[model samples]
Target chain A: MTKLIVEVQDLWKSFYIRHNRNDSLKERFISLFDGRRRERREVFWALKGVNLEVAQGEMVGIIGPNGSGKSTLLRVIAGILRPTKGSVTVRGSVAPLIEIGVGFHPELTGQENIYLNASLYGLTRKEIDRIYDEVVEFSGLEDFIDVPVKNYSTGMYMRLGFAIAIQLDMDILLVDEVLAVGDEAFQRKCLAKMQEFKERGKTILFVSHALELVSELCDRAYLLVNGQVILEGVAREVVACYHRGQIPIRHE
Target chain B: MGSWMRGLTRIIRYRELVRNLVAKDLKVKYRGSVLGLLWSLLNPLAMIVVYSLAFQYILRIPLENYPLFLITGIIPWNFFSGAVIASSEAIIGNANLLKKVKFPLEILPFATILFNFVQLLFALLVFFPAVFWFKTGVTPLILLYLPVLALQFLFTLGVAFFLSSITPRYRDVRHLTEVALMVLFWLTPIIYSISMVPGKLQPLIKANPLTAFITVYQDIIYWGRLPSTEMLISMVLWTGLSLGVGYSLFRRRQRVFVEEL
Candidate 1:
C-alpha cells in the first residue's frame, strides 16, 4: 500500500472583516478618547471543517469554484496559513508553486532570479549549481540568461518561473493554477514533466479549474464548495459529480 | 531539539536564502539610478554637509573637526535607523510571499536588517577615506569596533524582528517608527559631542540605549580610544534585553501575521 503523505483533519480557518477603517494605530489612539469612535469586526470563515488525505505518489486535484476555499486549503497544507481548528500534517518538505515567480525581482537577470527562486524553495547553492543548466535549458531562455527579466516577454517570464519551480527537490509539490500562464507547447512540456514526477513516486497536490486536465492527470480528485470537501473519489467520477451540480448540503 | 536549538537550526539552514535576499535588495536598491551604489555614500555625505554647516558654521560650535565628529555618529546612526525603519514594513511589504510561501517569517526582517548592514559597510568605506584624510589619530582601539558592531547588530536584529511582526497588525507602526526615530535621533548624540551637553543632562543621555552605541563609534573613530567601562556594560545589557524582548514578542506574534496581512 502507498503511504499517506498528507493528512488534513477537520481544518477550519477564519479571518476578521473590519467594519471600519479604524484598524490603524492612529485611529485606535483617537478612538480611545472619543466616545463616538466605535470600530467593529466580523469573523469570516474561509474554511469550515475541511478534511482531506492524499496518498504517496498520488496526483490529487482540488476543484472548486471561485472563493470556494480551494486556495485556502492549499495554503494551510503548505504551512503558510494556520488552520483555525484542525491539523494539517505532511510527511515531508513541500514546494509551493501557488503563484509563479513568487520572489522574482524584475530588475534581476534570469540567471540571478533562478538562483533566488530556487533558494527560496530551500535549495542550497551547491544543489542549485547542479540544476542551474537544466532549469535554464527547460525554460528555453538561453539567449536571454544574462538579460534582466523585466525585458523578457510574458511567455519567457512564466516559462522561467515554471522552470525554476518544477526543478526543486521536494517530496510533495503543491501546484495552484500556475500552469495556466504559459503557452500550449510549454504546458505540454509541463505535463510531460509532471508525468516524470509521478513515475518517480512523488506526491502532487494540484489545484486547478481545468476539469479535462484534472480527469486526465489526477489519479483521484477532491471537490470543495463553500469551505468543505463535498466529494472525493476517482478523478472522472468526482468531475462528473461536480458537473452534475451535486454540491453537498451545507453543514450550517 | 529545544526550541532555541530548533530556531538556531532553522536559521542556519536558511542562511543561503538570507544571503540571496540580501543580495537582491542591494541590487534592486541601485539598479535603475544613475549614481547607483555611489548614492549610499553620497546620502550620508549630504547629511553631514547640512548638519555641519548648520551647527559648526551657523551655531558656532567650538569643537574642531566637527564634520568628522558628525560623520562618526551619523554613519552608525544611519545603520540603526535604516534597519529599524525598513524592518517595520518588512512583513507588510512582502505580503505576496507571506501569503504563498511557507518559510520563516523572521527571515524577512533578518534579511532587511542585513541589507541595511551591507549598505552601512559601503558607507563605512567612505568613512575610512575621511578618517585618513582628517588624520583622526589612529589607535589599537579601532580593533575593538568589531565587538561593538556585533553587539549593535544583535540589538538592531531584535528590534527589527519585533517591529516587523507588530507592523502588520498596527499599520500606524510604520508612521510611529518614523516619528519615533526622528525623536530618538535628536535624543541621541549624533550631531554634537556628549560633553557639550550640560552635566545635569548626562544622566538623561545615559538612559537612551542608542547613546552607548553612538558613543562607542565616536570613541574609536573620533577620540581613538576604548569605550568607557560603563558604556560597554550598558551595551551588553541593552543588547541582551532588546534581543530577549524583541525575539519573544516576535515569536509570539508571527503565527497571526499572515491573517493580519
Candidate 2:
C-alpha cells in the first residue's frame, strides 16, 4: 500500500464568538465591577470530529456548502489552526495555498515578495534562487517583477501567488479556492500545473466549490455538511450524492 | 531538554525566514524616502539637543560633554523602547500571514526587534564620530560595546516576546507599553548622571532592568572604563530572567495565537 502521507484522526476545532468584545483594559476593568456588563461569549465549533487519510500521490477534493467548515479543515491540516481534540499526523512538508497572496507584502516589489512568500514556506535563499526564474516564467509576470505588488491587478497578484506555490518543492499541497481569482487562461494554466503536480507523484488536498472541476480533477472526495462529513467515496459518486441533495441518517 | 533542542533546530531551519522578514521591514520602511536611513538618526539627535539644552545649559548638571553621555544612553534606550513599542503590533499586524502560514510565530516579534536593532546600529555608526570628538579618545574598554549591546538586544527581545504574545489577547497592551516606557524613561539615567540621584534612590534606579544596560553603555562609551562587576552580573541576570520568562510565556500562549487573533 502507498504510504499515508496525511492522517487526521477525530480532529475538532472551535472558536469563541464574543457578543461584546471587551479586549480592552477599560472594559475588562468595568466588567469586573459590574456583573451585568460582563461580556457574553458562545463556543463555535468549526470542525467536529473529522477523520481523514490521504495516501501519497493522491489528489483529494473536499466539498461543502458555505460555512460548512471546508476551509477550516484545510487550515487545521496546514497547522494554522490547532485542533481542540484529537491530533493530525502529516508525514511530509506542506505548501498551503489556502489563500493566494497570503504573505505577499503589497509595499514590496513582486520579485521581493516572491522571496518573502517562499521563505514563509521555509525555503532557503538558495532554494528560492534556484526556483526563482521558473516561478517568474510560470506566473508570466516578467515585466512587472520589479514593480511593487500593490500596483498589480488582482489577477496578476493571484497568478504570482499560484506560480510561487506550484513551483516550490514540497510533498503536500493544500489549495483552498485559489483558482477562483485568476482569469480563465490563468485558471487553465493552473489546472495543467496541478495535473503536472499529480504526474510528479505529489499529494494534493483541494478545497473548492467548483463541483464539476472537483469531480473531474480529484480521484476521491468528501462531502461535508454542518461540520460533519456526510459522504465519502470516488469523486464522481460524491459529487452525484451532493447533486441529489441526499442527507443520510446518522445512527449516532 | 529534547523539546528545547527541537525548538532550536526549528528556529535554525527558519533562519532564512527571519532574514527575509528583517529585509522586508527595512525595505518597506526606507522605500519611499530619499533620506531613508538618516531618518532613524533624527529622533535621537533631536532628543540629544533638547536634553542638552535643558540639563547642560539650563540645569547645570556639571557633567562635561553631556551630549556625549546622552548619546550613549539615549540611543540604546531608544532601541529598547522602539522595539518594545513595535512588538505590540508584531503579531497582530501579520494577522494574514499567521492565519494562512504555519512557520514559527516567534519570528514576527523577533524580526521586529532585529529591525529596530538595525536602526540602532545605524545610529551608533553615525554618532561614534561625535563620541570620539567629545570624549577623551579611544580606550580598550570600548571593545566591550558589542557584548553589552548584545546583552541589551536579548533583554529587549525577551520583553518583545512577552509583549507581542499578550497583545493579541489584550488589545490595550500597546497603550500600556507606551505608558510604561514613558515611566521607565525617567527612571533610567539617560539625561542625568547616576551620581546626580541621591544615594537612597540609587538602588531603586539600579533595580530597573534597563538601568544596568544603559549604565553599561555609558560606562564603556562615555566613561571609557570597564563596567563594575555588579553591573555585569545585573546585565547577565536581567537578560536571563527576561528571556526565560518571556520565551516560556510565549511558548505557552503561541498555540492559541491564531484563535485569539
**Clash pairs for candidate 2:** none
Report chain B TM per candidate.
0.96, 0.97
Candidate 2 error regions (>4 Å) = A249-252, B1-4
lDDT by residue for model 1 (A1-252), tens = 779999999999998887765768878889889857767779899998888899888999999899999998989999998888989999998988888887778899999999888877777889999999999999999999999898988888989988887788588989999888789999999999988988898999999999999988999999988888889899989998898888776666
TM-score of 1: 0.95
List RMSD in Å for every model shown.
Answer: 1.9, 1.3
Evaluated with lDDT, which candidate comes out highest?
2
Residue A40, candidate 2: C-alpha displacement in angstroms: 2.8
Off by over 4 Å in 1: A34-37
> lDDT by residue for model 2 over B126-183, one digit each (tens)?
9989976884777888889998889999899889889998998899989888999999
C-alpha lDDT of all candidate models, in order: 0.88, 0.90
